[model samples]
Target: VKEICSYMGVSSDTVYRWVETHEMPVHRMGRLFKFKISEIDAWVKAGGANRKPQKGNSQ
Candidate 1:
């Protein structure tokens, strides 16, 4: 998980927070946290950020 987080340029705490908020794909490996590479891919593809569009903003 640390390795994956490093690859994403985020800290372990950020990943854990994602888990807590159910924002990231993950599973419990027994009593420990586990995340598969596929899961990460899907999560990224599913849109990782939660941003609200600006009012009166034009693209």
Candidate 2:
């Protein structure tokens, strides 16, 4: 989470929110969240991170 936050310039909370609401591709190792740079790049290129949450949803 720390690495990704640095890479993306976003907070850990934002990453967690994206994972929950935007289907950001991530691997779960028990309680740990794992990410691949390639997958993250692809997701970003595909506009995954630019998506807004649905109406009535709160971050």
Candidate 3:
């Protein structure tokens, strides 16, 4: 999580919040969350990170 946060240049809180609120590319195993570098790269390229919260949707 920390690595992904640093790679994305965002805080851990933001990552966690996005996982909870947005459709970020992530997987969970038991209590742990996992991500794939390739998938993350693709997601970023697809404007996943640039997405803004929708109107009327609280973040």
Candidate 4:
């Protein structure tokens, strides 16, 4: 859990809140939170916000 939090750059509390608030899907294994890497990656992709163009990419 801590590792995933670090990878996502979010606190554990935030992750819990996200789960509680239905921000993302969560998997449970015998009362333990088990998040799959693929799910998280998919969630991040699905939750992507519009990005602005950078000057460097404008060329």
Candidate 5:
């Protein structure tokens, strides 16, 4: 999570929220969340992170 946070230039909280709200690609292992740089790059290139949060949704 920390690594991805650094890579994405966002806080850990934002990453978790994106995983829940924006379908951010992630792998869950037990209680851990793993991320791949390639997947993240693709997601960004595809504009997954540019989506605005929906109305009435709180982040």
Candidate 6:
């Protein structure tokens, strides 16, 4: 998780929120979350990480 967070340059909370909202690609193994560098790279390339402003966001 830390590695993924570092690679994505985001905090763990953001990652968790993305996973919960089905916005990020990840795998679950029991209580563990798994990720592949290739898949994440592909997702980003496809604009998965291009976050749009939420409806109520102040920013």
**TM per candidate:** 0.69, 0.84, 0.80, 0.68, 0.82, 0.80
Kindly give the number of clashing pairs for every candidate: 0, 0, 0, 0, 0, 0
Better of 2 and 4 by TM-score: 2
| Cα lDDT tens digits for candidate 3, 21-56 | 665788999999999999989988998877976655
**Residue lDDT tens for model 5, 1-59:** 99999988999999998887746889989999999999999999988898876766544
Per-residue error (Å), model 1, residue 50: 4.1
In the range 1-59, model 2's lDDT, one tens digit per residue, is: 99999999999999999887746889989999999999999999998888887765544
Name the regions of candidate 6 deviating beyond 4 angstroms. Answer: 51-59
Clashing pairs in 3: none
lDDT of 6 by residue, 1-59 (tens): 88999999999998887777676889999999999999999989988888653554331
List all candidate RMSDs to the true structure. 8.0, 2.8, 2.5, 11.1, 2.9, 4.9
Question: What lDDT does candidate 6 reach at residue 42?
Answer: 92
Which residue pairs collide in model 6, if any? none
TM match of model 1 to true structure: 0.69
The window of 10 residues in a row where model 2 has the poorest summed lDDT is 50-59
In model 4, which runs have C-alpha deviations exceeding 4 angstroms? 48-59
Question: Relative to the unseen true structure, what is the Cα RMSD of model 5?
Answer: 2.9
Q: Using lDDT as the measure, what is the rank order of every candidate, best first? A: 2, 5, 3, 6, 1, 4
TM-score-superior candidate, 1 or 2:
2
lDDT tens string, model 1, 32-57? 87778887887777786343334544
Q: For model 1, what is the C-alpha lDDT against the true structure?
A: 0.71
Q: Give the best candidate by TM-score.
A: 2
Best by lDDT: 2
Which of 2 and 3 is the better model by lDDT? Answer: 2
Q: Find the 10 residues in a row with the least total lDDT in model 5.
A: 50-59
Candidate 4 RMSD to the correct structure:
11.1
Write the residue-wise lDDT of candidate 4 on 1-59 in tens digits: 68779879889987776666555567878878888888888878976212222344321
Q: Please list the residue runs of candidate 2 whose C-alpha ends up more than 4 Å from where it truly belongs after superposition.
A: 54-59
- Give candidate 6's TM-score: 0.80
